[model samples]
Target chain A: MRNRSILIISLPLLIATLLVVMSLSITLGSASVDWQTVWRVIFSKITVINQWVEPDWADTTETIVWDLRMPRVIQGAIVGSALALAGAIYQGVLRNPLADPFILGVSSGASFGAALVFALGWQIMWLGQFTLPVVAFLFGFGSLMLVYFLARVGNKVRMETIILAGVVVQAFIGACLSLVMALANEQLQTIVFWMMGSLSLTEWSYNYVVFPIIAIIAIISLFFARELNMLSLGEEIAHHSGVSVSRTRFYLLILASVMTGAAVSVSGAIGFVGLVVPHIVRLIVGADYRLILPLSIIGGAIFLVGADTFARTILAPREIPLGVVTAFLGAPFFAYLLRRAKREYF
Target chain B: MLTISNVYKHLERKQLLNEVSFNVGNGRCVGLIGPNGAGKSTLVKLISGLEEPSGGTIKIMGKDIRQWSVKKLAQKVSVLTQDGLSPYPISVFDAVLMGRYPHLSFFQREGKRDIQRVEEVLEFTGLADFRDQMLDTLSGGERQRVAIAKAMVQEPELLLLDEPTTYLDIGYQMNVLNLVKDWQERESLTVLMVLHDLNLAAQYCDELILMDEGSIVKRGTSEEVISAQMLKEVYHASPEIVRHPKLNIPQILL
Candidate 1:
């Protein structure tokens, strides 16, 4: 009851925080727009839906706010929520708190796929403007299937085998990625920048494609939240309590993998958002997925929006990699949590 | 309520149980007493449908166990193992309410009756005060009680316990058995518990099945299954057996 009430209170506060951060994010870019214009442009666009009044503010200001920063902020929130949701499911299904979206080798495979596209320079437009994401998602999901099959001993995939398989697949893909990088020196910058993950290239088109994918997945995952709660206890206990262990594990794996694949494909492997957000949320709220899932979704969006804002603003006129910013913020918090927890979770 | 015949269980090319057979009547508490490595846990696993029997058929309530779906089967049977504690932090109330998983469909949430049932079980188990506390915050005995409460919330017709009191101190052992006994009578629950303590088994169980070398050596009332000669042959220990002064049940003293 206490936990439920805390959730009820914190959820709205988190949304308010997210809105505040997003508004602050829109105002913090290289071109500074006054708070009044920012609010006028937003509220006029919202209240006067079709008849958006020409902002008395400069055209550059309108373009900067609506054209550039808006999509980036939304992408940041989408990618953040997707990765964090996948991480919670991974941790629950594998019964390992350390498990993250990248634990199954999704990031390395995504890098490999994106690097392959760069090396080949095959400009065959498959999925309109987001061809790179499509290819990257397929290859990333392919690598996950490979690791899964390799690690599975029989009907069960042991924890040790999963870690070992992930490491092995990651190393193999890393080798391939380096070979591609060395061969295609001219395309190296494009590949490396994408691998570091940036929201700079985001457009409303990308949002149009990515938002529904993640939102639908997150909503579907909530239905299985209770099964995930059972899975965390132990497989046998879960089975005795009427969870079809193998089926639940399989469905959750697919759901988490799809979310990770989509996020990595678009954002080029944003690290630690998936790993850190769930842990921090679990600490604040308890480990019940019913609460953890929704809270982590909101918490992750807030975190990434705040981090991306800092990334674009920290070294003004020169942007740090979004991944670097997240790692910088996430690693210390992770270390603090590790020291504080003292391997309690392990 | 439960019947096993010629059941065989093998793992990694090693036979764990060979031609094990037993019948547990409805509304009776049966204790399975065995030495270490005697396949007591394996038998419990088979009965609970966690593992399949290598070569025999088991039935429950006159229906073949294999014919029932796992979810439906779980609705009628619940298992309590010693190591069933949640490693993650889960509130006692939420953990106990998970026992209603079988009754709920995929899209269904826990209804009011489910919560009421969990509260009743927690009250019966003396864990009502700790309902909002996390499982990890509870002590060993307290956690065991929570585990029992979780199982009781399942409202199963048959309960399978694999050394449920293995890690508890003696007082907790008695407490656990007393709780199980009280519930057995109140709910008319059929219990198949694996026990290490012969005296406690004799005191609480209506019948005893003594197992050795992955097979049942003897099974009958406490007086028939637990004797000085049988103890010496099965456990490789010479224990003096005496009748309890108040209960008239056989008690083993070493």
Candidate 2:
């Protein structure tokens, strides 16, 4: 009962915060628009029935909001929510508080896929456009599968082994990516942009591909939220409690991989949001995955939107990569968490 | 009824349990006594289906444990192993409610009946007030009781406890044992418990199985198993066994 009320209150607060962040993000970009124009653009598009009394800044506002900023914001929301949800599931399955979406080498796998595209210069053959991100997604998911197979032994996948395997695979793939970059001198800027992570290149078409994938995976994960809670108690206990350990684990890994791969395909390698957002939500909502999963989604969206907004305005005409801004904020907080955890666990 | 026949468990090419076999009737409290590394815990693990025996079969209710689905076996037998830490904070009520997971469908929420059962178990375990408390904050004894409460909530036909009182104080130990004894009588439960304290086992158990080197060395009533010679042979420790003046059960002195 109390949980329901907390959810009710928190949902609105999170939505309102995200809305404010979205507004700031829409207004503060290189093409600085007034708050009234931003509001007019949003409301006019939203309520298109009364289009007879159109505002003067309608076309310009539409170009800025619909053509440019809206897709970026939507992309940011989708990617953020995907990463956070994946992180929550990963943490639950491993029963490790520090486990995140990237713990299974999804990012590196995606990087490897991206690198292959760069190395081989295989531009999308059938699909005229939409090449790079598709290749990124495939490679990202493939690497995740590879890492899972490498870590799995018979019926068990130990937590430590999974992490160590991820680190090793990640390092190997990272080295390969660097080698490719060194060879392709002309594509250095492109490779660096992809590596650093950005939302600048996102278009409406990108949103069409990423959003449904994120939504489907997220909903499926939310359906298994309670099972995730059962898993958090430990594998043996979960099995005794009637959970099929292997089946639950396999589904969760696939779902997390899908979410991570989709998010990385669109946003490059945005870190910390996946790792930190779920942890912060856990602090507020306790470890019940049912609550934590949904809360992390909201929290992640708000966090990334706010961070992206700050990134856009803080440097004015020169925009920093969203990943850099997130890392700048996330790295220090992550260190603090590590120190606190050391004190608690050690 | 529970039966183990010719069970052999090996870990890393070393024999952990060697051709151990035992049987117990319905509603009987059977105590498994052993020193450290005697494979008492391993035997319990085998019976609980946590670990498969390398060369033997465990049968519960005349059906081979391997034949029973994990959920079906869980409904029949519940195990409370030695206290282990949980990674996250959970309420006492929710922790105990986990025992009902086997009975619940994947999407089923805990209804009022489930909540009532949890409350009843908490009250019976003398943990009603602590229902909402986080388990990590509890004392060792309290945590042990919570563990017992979790197993009890399963409402199993057979209860298995592994060193349930290891970290408990004498008072809490007695409280827990007495509570389990009362439940055994009320529910007609068949209990298989691994106990380190011989006196407690003597006082509580209907039959005692003394284990040594991963095999059963002696099997009888408390009177038969709690003798000085048996203790000396199995444990390699000399101890005095005497009758309790009030209860007339065997008591031991180290």
**Which one is best on DockQ?**
1
Lowest summed lDDT window (length 10), candidate 1 chain B:
B82-91
Q: Residue B242 CA error for candidate 2 (Å)?
A: 1.2
Worst lDDT 10-window in candidate 2 chain A: A337-346
DockQ for every prediction shown:
0.70, 0.44
Residue A89 lDDT in candidate 2: 85
Over A1-346, each residue of candidate 2 has an lDDT whose tens digit, in order, gives: 5566778999899888887878778887767888777777777776564474467875776798878998888888888899888988888887776787888888877876776676677787885456778888888887777777788887777767777888888888888888888888777777777767788788999899889888988887888976787677777667666577777888999999888998898788888898888987876667677688889998889888877777677887778888889889877876776666522321
Question: What clash pairs does model 1 have?
Answer: none
Cα-based TM-score, every candidate: 0.95, 0.92
In candidate 1, what are the lDDT values of residues B125-181, reduced to their tens digit?
999899888787777888888878888998899999888888899999998889989
What are the RMSDs of all candidates, in order?
A: 2.0, 2.8
- Give every candidate's TM-score on chain A: 0.94, 0.92
Q: How well is candidate 2 docked (DockQ)?
A: 0.44
